[model samples]
Target chain A: MRKLIVVLTLCVISSLALVAQGTPLPDSTSDSTAQLLQQAHALYERLDLERAVPLLERVLSPGWSFGMTKAQRVDAYAYLGASLALVGSADSAARYFRAALERDPFTDLDPRRFTPGQVAVFRTARRQTFAVGARQVSALRFDPRTEQLSFTVVTTHGATLRVEVRSVDATPGQVLFQGESDGLREIAWNGLMADGRLAPPGRYEVRVDGRSRLLSRSDSTRVYFDVRHELPALEDTLHELLLSELRPERYPPSAATGDLVKGLGIAAGAFVISGALADGDLGSRSSALPATVAATAALSGVVAFVWRRHHAEAPENVLANARRRQERRLTNDAIQRRNNARIAQTILVIAPASGVGP
Target chain B: MRPAFAHASGPLVLLALAAGAPTAAGQWTVQGTGVLSVMRHRVDAGYGVEPSSGVLAGPEVAASLRDRLTVRLWTRSGSFHADGPGAIDRDVAEAGLQVDVAALRWLTVQAGTTRRTYLTVLARQPWTTVALGAEAHLPFTETGVTGIVRGAILPGVSVNGLGHPDLAIAVASGMEYRRGRASAAVLYSLERYRFAPSATATVERREQLAGLVVSVGWSLKR
Candidate 1:
């Protein structure tokens, strides 16, 4: 009876072990968190901040760590806070931003990174100041997109104001508004040409009617108005507006590894099949299989070799030769000395203009 | 004049202009660089300079919309020669799209399509390739609907289908020991295609090409 009991106990233990082995392991929260993070990043890159914010919040709530060091974590927090601010939730954004600052008190953080949208808000909120004076009717230009213009007027006031927007290219000779206030009356010109169309792209001028009242004398106020086109480069523009926002550090290298492994497995299988035919089989079947394998392997090898050679050699040779030629023309020491001299010359030239009173 | 007010207001005005003007979103920049290429074909007999040898010029343009999505367009024009005739000039254009999902920290799914004209000895041929792909630093290539798992024993991979009834699958894995400027990679790719018999050909052929590729790329952009 005792022997029977011992056997039963052993059987029970074995069954428990089998059951434990058969049951799959629990899913990892880290992986789910990472996936969520990736989705959020994609949404953010697509400019769907409305979608990204919620996804990021979800991932963050899971108490996830992207295998980052403490310093990196601090940086991540700051970026997260800034990103939130960009999507229009200023309060939450500010909270995250503060948290990031708290984590790294010594770092000189640029608040502008979090306030792209805020700049517009602030500008609109600021009090609108329109200049007052009897300005001359010399030239006028206006840009409706920027809601600004340039004008010239003959006024006695040394108080004549010139507003120049460097980022906009306004249409030339356009009139916008005409109005009055106090002893200081104003004429607002909605910059439009006589043809009822926006003026040609150039500098514009507006003449205020009451310039003489402020100046207390009639002096020609020469307002040189220049307009510049403020357009972002294609690459930068695309990156800002459409490219996915991915923090390269948060990505795992495992995906790349897994792909390599899968390919290796396929290659190994082929190699094994070819080896089996060569070693065990005989007659036409064996010979044909081996031959087929050898031919496929050789063709693949050639194609791969050609592709790599083309990709590497062509680009490298061109770049290397050019670099060598450039190097031959100027040694490192000589280049450094030349740069230093140029720097000195610039400093000397700018010093007088800076009113240092040499 | 107060220096503080002058300096403070200058940047403030600039910032206002940058923020308020929609025109600030579009601009053109010129990037000039020289590229010299040398290529040797394994199937072809001899090599001196590669078939395509010369300076390459291209216009690269990118645009951003709504602050999250970006589109990039690039056009390259150059000349290459076949063994028979005078050098033939060719033009190639490519466009790419990147979608950033905020949930994934390091992975941005990328899709690109490209068109090229092959000017050869016999005739000029046009080929268009479409690629719907995603790249992650992981090892497995996900396809169809199985791309959701973060650690499903499969790494992320890209699959591209060519216009010539050929399907290409490639998987790559590597480690960058010294901050990615220098690294080694092992890449494996499989291409399967059915080659139809041409007018001069005697047989129809179905072919599969599979191989391992080892590569190293240095970062020269910086």
Candidate 2:
């Protein structure tokens, strides 16, 4: 009887102790709130917001330590708040907004989206939020005479800035510059791809992404592109000019040749007329002079015909067609360059809701 | 019966006037010709007859109607020293009309009427002649050297309104040197005449008239 009572008491205490373990476990082996938050995000992306809300709530539940970085925590609460709001529980969403700002005082939402009025309840919570803004990389210009191209980026206070210069076409070129810098960052590019060859004339994009560590929830990024056209060398230009002159168009047979044909015809006709007038009486004299003049005319006519045949206009047409093909190729390249120059980007600002005002 | 000279001369004048018009093909052409000929008459032509050897100067006008046909008008006048029995000073006028039809590129058929009238002694006795002929041209590729042949049959001869079966013929062969619109040719032609017995002349008279005609011609077009 005594042994039985002791065993039963031991079992009861063990049951009570296990019940006293305050935090909830996701499952038997883990209480990782980050994994739970990731699962909830997947559910939210899948449009199962109702299911995602419960998972997000579990991450914020009492006695559960969601060991996430400052950025990660802001992201989690923002995801939960957004999911709760999507599920039509604005009141429940407001609590997560307040809790996010308690972690990072300058917390804000993506300004372009989720306007402050959308979460008016969080607007009162964000009294001490930090400002977030970005500057165009083109503010830092390179010297015109130098081969190197330099640029700079400016971010908000205590911000982490990353700048990159990449080809606008995005596929054929290598990263010309990529690095992290302080709130005020400066970079130089040698105008060459990773292959060490001088970059061809083309469009290139400069991108800057920034986040202030002092205020994890406020972040901004800017992207824009520029076009460069490299002029040809003098030797190349001269060579092309000479090459164009090499195959001269001789057809449409020049005006001088046409005049030659007309003049020859006239001379032949004059010989024929002269022969006619020089004809004499047939008594004792033979008519040899007229025959000689006729012979001169016949020979002249033959020469004129030969000249007309050799100077025909077909070769000029062939050269013209070749020139047209070259023009089309140049026009197509210009259009491609114009299209690249039209590259567009929208500035992105990333933030989340903040805490309620004290 | 009308005089044969009047019959032949009327057609000649008509041809001469018709050639004065032009055509639309731009191919209408007129040709002026000068011919100097030497002639020999076969028999003595009685009173005031021409000499055995005589010179005939003829001037002609010819027009080709497009490329297919040609019409020519000619007049010849001659003066001869009388040399036969009871001869006297004499003159003769000959007028003629000739038409040529191009039967082929190489061949042409011709017909003409000619009348010869004595101006002095035998003025009342005018002789008329009718001719049918064909000409062939053999052209060389050189466009200058050409061989020509002509033959004619004279079916009848008329004098003072009377017709005679004279069995007369004419033939010629020549070489020509030609250029576009211009040519020169020299040919020898033989014309034969035969007359039946008459009240005043008992035996038949056969006369062979032979001549070398030198001709130069030019084409004018509108």
Candidate 3:
């Protein structure tokens, strides 16, 4: 007799499920929401509450539609309420159940299917979504070592969300994290900036923004994070900065080349002039005066040619050359030695290789 | 009297201008040096008796544009009596330009030309010579004292084809003390002048002079 009764109950449950499925869901149902509801139901049957509860809550709270048929609406509310009750949100479950009845008084709640506490709590429901509650967000905790930032957002319904880290003045902002809550009660961020870098240590405000059909809201939390490095690293950074400053800003390789060529030409000019001058002084030894004078004239012509040659340098280039000279003077060996001595205290050096062991 | 002032003044003015020029330009270099040398000379063949001894002293001032080119003006005079009636004497004033290339860490090669006015009792005969020279330096321990070797040979013509047509070879070995751009050296040198036969002097003549030279230098670059 018991077996027969159990079989009858099974048949009734199967028909109820079929009837729900065959009811021609609302034409306005978004394919996405339909898929989510189907997945939630499957997970609930498999007892994957960790995954199913959020999906059911998402389908009910924000995914719920006024355009849905009475059957569809009842399905969302009943499933969401059952999921919430299973997760121990008895009061919230009852609230959703009452919200359904407010829309359609003929809503059915099976006592045999739901816990006694859920039934008792359901009796206290007053209105639809309006009574679900105000939107609230709180930062759970931040762990600097793990770089994990955790937070919770409770919304009366599903919301599109955006998260950011910004200066106290709300300027210098960057997006930190964002997503549809998908009924997720908690969020954890690995404390990475958009570029996946651990943000430099400073005071910054974390902002969470939510927008739903009925309302839009934002909440902020302040965090000050510090990243510490060894003294050697700081020293190395300073050394590099100083080295960079000491480096010549402009390398005018061609500038010196032309000057060097000019110098060579000048030396050659001096050489020939010296030669002609000597010849003129010794002209008394022979009557080769005309020949010597011609040679002298030729040398003079060369000198004139060299002297007439123009050297063009821009005004800025001249200044830059002077600046480079000054920088070069700064590297006098003695001064460099002294500066190196002063900095050597902080330079970490590995021991040199020793001779073979005895 | 010889225009001792003229001979002295030209180099003096060059040095003054070189010194003043660098000071004005703010980056040129000037180096002044004074050398005192004791010399002994030998006549290579039948021309004279034994040997002669003399003193040579000079001052050199060089102006440089950076590290590449240098213009140096110098003057030196030496007088000595032979065993017989005559004296072998020379008083010279010259200006030179050198292009130096550092060939190694402790060595340098230089090429240059010199205009030399050789003073005689009759007149001053000027000569031009081009030379290739090499210099090597060695540190004596870490005490900042350096040993130096310098050698040069003039193989080119006497300019205008009228002056001493001789191959002049000079070599000096020295020890120097240097600090910054200033240095002091005590040197010994052997200098040889081999003259080709000319219309005025028929016989080929070779004169070799060995000398001890002491010099001190100071630079304006620093």
Of candidate 3 chain A, the 10-residue stretch with the lowest lDDT total is A349-358
Rate residue B180 of model 1 by lDDT.
31
The DockQ of each candidate is 0.03, 0.03, 0.02
lDDT of 2 by residue, B1-222 (tens): 223343444454444344445545577687666666665443433322233546776667787877579987887767555545554555666888889999999899999998877555555557688899998875532335454567788875776633374557776544456676676765555566656667656655554555555677656666
lDDT of each: 0.35, 0.55, 0.53
Report the C-alpha displacement of residue B117, candidate 2, in angstroms: 1.3
Model 2, runs deviating above 4 Å: A1-358, B1-25, B44-51, B82-89, B120-123, B198-202
Model 3: per-residue Cα lDDT over A128-208, one tens digit each: 232111122232333434445554443334556666655343365666546664233455555445565544433444555
Error of 3 at B49 (Å): 5.1
Give the docking tier of candidate 3.
incorrect
Q: Comparing 2 and 3 by lDDT, which wins?
A: 2
Error of 2 at A50 (Å): 15
Error of 1 at B119 (Å): 0.6
Per-residue lDDT over A127-171 for candidate 1, one digit per residue giving the tens place of the 0 to 100 score: 111223333333332344444333333222234333221112332
**What is the Å distance of residue A26 in model 1 from its true position?**
97
Q: State the local distance difference test value for candidate 1.
A: 0.35
lDDT tens digits, residue span A122-201, model 2: 55334323333333334332323354555555543455555555555654554433344433445666655667644444
Better of 1 and 2 by lDDT: 2
Native-structure RMSD, model 2: 18.8
